[model samples]
Target: MKTFNAKVNVTLKKSVLDPQGQTVLEALHSLGYKGTENLRVGKYFEVTLNAQDENSAKTQLKEMCEKLLVNTVIEQYEVHLS
Candidate 1:
C-alpha cells in the first residue's frame, strides 16, 4: 500500500441559493473589491489515506465525499489525489 494525499473541493450546486457567498460578495464590494463578482463560498478538505494506486486513491476520496464529506442533494464534490 502507498500513502496518498487528496484534496476535496465541495461546492453548492448552481441551482441552489448561496447566501453565504452573496454575503461575502457584498462585503467585498463594500471593501472596494468591485472587480469581484459572482463569488461563491465552498469547502476544501485535505486528506491522507492509504491506497494501492492513484486510481484507488481517487476512488476512495470520491467515495468519502459521497458518503459523508458532501451533501449530494445540494452540493457536489471533486477529488484530486497525489
Candidate 2:
C-alpha cells in the first residue's frame, strides 16, 4: 500500500451568501487593511490515506469530499495530492 496525502479546500459557491466572511471582511477593513478584498472563509482538510495507487487515492478522496467534506448544494472543493 502507498500512503497518500490529500489537501482539500472547501469554499462557498459564488452565489452563496457568506455571513462569516462578510464579518471578517468588515473586521479587516477596521484594522486598516484597505488593499484586500473578497475575503471568503471556508474549510481546509489534510487527509492521509493508504491506497494501492494514485488513482485509488483520488477516487477515495473524491468520495470523501462529495459525501461528507463538502456541501454540493452551496460549496465546492479542490483537491491537491502529494
Candidate 3:
C-alpha cells in the first residue's frame, strides 16, 4: 500500500447565506481594503491515508467527503488526492 494525501475544501452552496463571509467583507471595508467587494467562508482539511493507488485514494476521499466532510443539504465539497 501507498500513503496519499487528500485535500478537501468544503463550502456553502451559492444559495445559502454566508454570515461569516459577510462579516469578513465588512471587516475588509472597515480596514481600508476598499477594493475587496466580496468574501466567502469555507473549510479546508488535509488527510493522509493508505491506499494501493491514486484511484483508491480518490475513492477513499470521495467516501470520506460524502460521509463526513460535506453537508449535502447546504454545502459542496471538492477532494484532491496526491
Candidate 4:
C-alpha cells in the first residue's frame, strides 16, 4: 500500500446562511473596513491514507468525507489527493 495525503475543504452551499461569516463581516465593518462583502466560512481537513493507488485513496477519502467529515445537508466538499 502507498501512503497518500488528502486535503478536504468543506463549505456551506451558496443557498445556506452562514451566521459566523456574517458576524465576521459585521465586525470588520464596525472596524471601519467598508470594502468587505458577503462572507462565507468553511473548514479544512488534512488526512493520510494508505491505499493501492491514487484512485483508491481518493475513493476512500470521498467515503470518509460523506460519512463523517461533512454535513451533507448544509455543506459541500472538495477533495485533493497527493
The top-ranked prediction according to lDDT is 2
What overall lDDT goes with each candidate model? 0.90, 0.96, 0.91, 0.93
lDDT at 61, model 2: 97
**Residue 37 local lDDT, model 3:** 77
Residues 1-82 of candidate 1 have per-residue lDDT tens digits of: 9999888899999999999999999999999999987988999999999999988888778778889999999998888777
TM-score of each: 0.93, 0.96, 0.94, 0.93
Best by TM-score: 2
Ranking by lDDT: 2, 4, 3, 1
Ranking by TM-score: 2, 3, 1, 4
Query: How far out, in Å, is residue 27 in model 3?
Result: 0.5
What's the lDDT for candidate 4? 0.93
Error of 2 at 35 (Å): 1.9
Off by over 4 Å in 4: none
lDDT of 3 by residue, 1-82 (tens): 9999888999999999999999999999999999997788999999999998999889888988888889899999888877
Better of 1 and 2 by lDDT: 2
